[model samples]
Target: MIDCISFFGLGKLGLPLAALFARSELRTLAIDIDRELVARLRAGQVPYPEPGLDDLLAEAEPRITYASEARGAFGTDASIILVPTPSDAGHPEFSSRHIEQACRDLCAALKARTEWRYHLIVISSTVFPGTVATRIAPLLEQLLGRRAGRDFGIAYVPDFVALGDVVRGFQEPQFLLIGSDDEESHAQAAALFRRIVAPGTPIQHLSIRDAELAKVAANVFLCTKISFGNFLAQLADRLGGADLDSIASALALDPRIGGGFLRAGSPYGGTCLPRDVDAFVALARSVDLDAPLASAVRDVNKAQYDLIERHLLAGNPRCVAVLGLSFKPGTSVTIGSPAFELVRRLAQRSVRVAVYDPAADARESAHAAFGDAITCHESITACVAAADAVLVCNSDPAFRGLAAKVAPDRRIIDPWGCVLGTHPGLVRIGRDQALAASLLASRRRKPSLRAVR
Candidate 1:
């Protein structure tokens, strides 16, 4: 039983994961290179917003310790690295410098330990295939002067959790993937997961390279599904009377295509999906192969964004209020967010923009990124009231009643089709006809609202 664990990198995913370990009764040493972050975690203050993380950290406060150096990890039985693997500028591959630096620091700490016990090192960071066996493992051996599997263990145990729903996602993972070169290393990593995951969770063991590929492949497959759904929507729009929602619903009935990412909406924008697709393409290219389907999927996603932009810019509303800023609901992350990109475009066109999200961190991110170019609002009502048009970006349930808030003449551009009602101004991206023409025609009628569940 691994009772003590150390986690490197205390960013969005890392802090929650470390807190989860501590909540599971493990004495966890969480380290980060940022002194301010370390200080905040030390004082039991979460540096960012993650649903349920504050309470989880509160529960784990007694069992968890925060540190700015690797020395604290020496006492832990296993060290897990969850550092960022940022995509390299002007390349499809990730820059592994951050992961490499973490490994180097950990190696120095391990070498200086006066007393040594066999320690397990697991990496949960996203990486390109062959990175572990070719780069990380060799670097560890060269720096520490110790052979893996004999003196210590190395395993790739990436977590498949998304932001906002990370707590539930972690506690109820569909399956666990463990990649290691040796049986002992695999066993150690598997034991840790078994302890945390619920009973009957499927666990697969694979070689280092396969696991790396599997992670990227899984994300790319999801992106494919999303793009396919968008493709259906586009086809439905081109062919009149073809309902995308109904078509998707029937397609989802097939066991092979059980409705996961089948809902048609804004382009699949986020920190993971786009990056993983690019990585897959980059990997295929590196091996003298072409992944046309993957490339097409990316192109389709970009097209969806263009479609939404066209709808939002219809009639050239003097001021537009974007209801959601985060890529998805329940997260403050604005990276690769369609709404954020829309704001940028609107700013460039000198279209006054107002933005609001449920999370303050997301609002702050927008304020910081756009400065005075955009206006951030504290409430949905205020944001909608300030603009002449409203663009519903994400499918946040809170935006369902937005039609009631908008004035009859003003338009509501909902790409996700999440907003319900027969308001004349409501423009459903995949469901409605050419937005500008329809909006022009609808203004010649009376608007009324009545609802029943």
Candidate 2:
């Protein structure tokens, strides 16, 4: 029974997992190199925005300890490495330097301990297929001067989580994937997951490399679904009378399809999906196997953005308000966000772009992407009030009432079908021409519906 656990890399995913472990009544130590971040956590401040995190942190505070050094993690019975394994330049493979360095530091801590005690080492970071067995295991064994399976148990147990819904995903994972060098290692990792996750959670134990492949494969499959939905959406838009929402909803009823990630919206973008697809493609290529489906998924996602750009530009709005800058709602991460890219392209075209996101740091993210070229609004109403067109990029709940906020002349480009009320200027991406024509006709009757540009 692992009563105490140490977590490496106290970033977005790491912190939440640590909190959950603490909430589960386990003594949890969270270690990070970032001094300020450690300071913030110790001060009872969350480093990032996550739903239910603050409350969870409060509940788990007594059992959770924050530390800036790796040595602080020495006494814990198990250590899970959750550090960033950033993608290598010009390739899909993730650089394992961060996790490697963490393992080295952890080795030093283990060496310094006078008494030898068995510890479970779990790699929770996403890595390439062969990373665990070839790279991580060898390096850890060399540094610690011990055998992985015998001296210390090691397992690759990547978390299947999305940024916005991480808390829920961690608490109630569909299934836990464990890749271990030995049976004992697998059981140790599974036991730890069982402690934190829901009762009777299904667990799949695989070889180290298989688990690595499964992690990326899962995301790639999801990206393929999203891209497929977008492709269907485009078909619906082009072939009048075809409804994407209805089609997707019907397709989702199939037991095999399972109805998740089938919604048609902006291209799939975030920290994980795009990168994972690219990595999977690269992984396939490394072994002389061509992944045409994965490649197509990537191409389709990029093309979806182009389609959106064309639609927004076609309207020729004097100013466009881009609502929801984050990749998706409920999180503040904006990496590969369609809204972020849309703002950049619109600004380059001198389209007068105004952006707002309820969760994201609009000013900071906008400045980082393009400095002062776009206006960041504090409120959604403020963002769309002056614009002739508003593009709701993400499916944030705050963006649902955009129809009531904007004037009838203001065009609402909703990709996610978030806007409910029927307004003349509301342009749904996947809707047929008849709906668009009706909206246009209503605007023409009003006579004040001239295009701003």
Candidate 3:
């Protein structure tokens, strides 16, 4: 019965969802306020670089339409709002202005309709708990002058897709969660997702408040796992004869602690994990509850970043190369990227830094972010060619086996253990012996102060 779908804010997540809906044989309309983005999308060009997005857009071109205004899509039976819910500046809460404006515009369009019928509105944006029920639902009703669950229905359904693998994630989700104010809204949303997802996909229905909390809670839990792994990695460094990779592998065997997000690497960064963890801590404090565990997770992550920076600085290499810029592999977005932060820190210390990423536009992104302070290279070999030290900040598959190619004399710092076995000049952060030896060798190679005198 749900044949038409309208998507608001067609950014990274929304675009793929819209394409998938169109691919599922539903007539889909993708709307955004950015005219340039809408123009590009209409020309069969993707505004952002996401793996498989171009192919999906092409496949759904026949059934998909791009628009710049919500008024153009009022004919659709359902609208899914995916606008940005940025974290408030100097606060733990999300800014509701974007979503609020989006709802107001949507209501204005719905008001223009000649006839009123049951319409479903699904919010796919991540918001603080009680946002849908307390804030959004009331705003929509006030604007449209219609009672919700009677004239219109609302559902909260946040997607759990990561940046690089969003398309594949939609096709094969571990579970589907729908939070609705009423059974009719829940059923309609569930029915639509069922058509798009694989048959028999597990779907859990809850109240709007629970769904909002669950979305952030899931991300916060993942952050905790990552921070715990980093803590273990630090322990391995302090305790002799311990390797984080080996220890993490052992921990993964236990069913309670899953294998995912357990890799000992750079501090977790990107759009979701870091901010959501902070938001969760804020939510706890808002209710007058102490979240020391969550707070500790953040503190541990900062320590991990500081540890890596300190290790990089200990080596007095005048020139250093960073091999990855984006937060993770398979996407070009550098928002909240550890590599970007590391590059900035190195530049601040007057260390000449060159960076590269196989998937990201390093030249444009790096230059825009750090302007003339850092050099951006197009390839891994070119980036490391002139540098005496190299840091593999991301676990991009392109960085695998990179150690075999680097000169034996140059120092290689790999926190993610992307490189294979030990090398004389290689220093793995979580493994102390290699790092100590690397430092010792560097110190011995330096000219003595007494000899200079």
Candidate with better TM-score, 1 vs 2: 2
Q: How many collisions per candidate?
A: 0, 0, 0
Residue-level lDDT tens digits of model 3 in 1-453: 688888899988999999999998999988899999999988888777888888999999999999999886678899999999998438778877788988987888888899987889999999988888779999998998899898889999989989989998887899999999798999999998887788878999999999999999999999899998888777766543246777788888999887889988999999888889889988998999999989999999998988888878877889999988888888888888999888888998899998888865645787898988888888899998998899998888788777777888888888888887666667788776655465556556875622421
Task: Tell me the TM-score of model 3.
Answer: 0.94
The C-alpha stretches of model 3 lying farther than 4 A from their native spots are 360-362, 432-453
User: Candidate 3's C-alpha lDDT?
Assistant: 0.86
Q: Each prediction's Cα lDDT score?
A: 0.85, 0.86, 0.86
What is the Cα-based lDDT of residue 275 in candidate 2? 87
What value of lDDT does candidate 1 attain over all alpha carbons?
0.85
For residue 15, what is the lDDT in candidate 2?
Answer: 90
* Model 2 lDDT, full chain set: 0.86
lDDT per residue (tens digit) for residues 1-453 in model 1:
578988899888888888888888899989999999898777767787778888988998888989998887767789999999999436779777888999888888888788777889999999888899888989988988889888889999887999888877887898999999998899999988776688899999999899999999999999999999888777655443245677778988999898889989888888888889999999999999999999999899988877777877887888999988999998889999989888988999899999999988889999999999888999999998968789998999999998788888888988777888867788787677465345435544525311210
Residue 167 miss distance in model 1 (angstroms): 1.1
| Structure candidate 1, residue pairs in collision | none
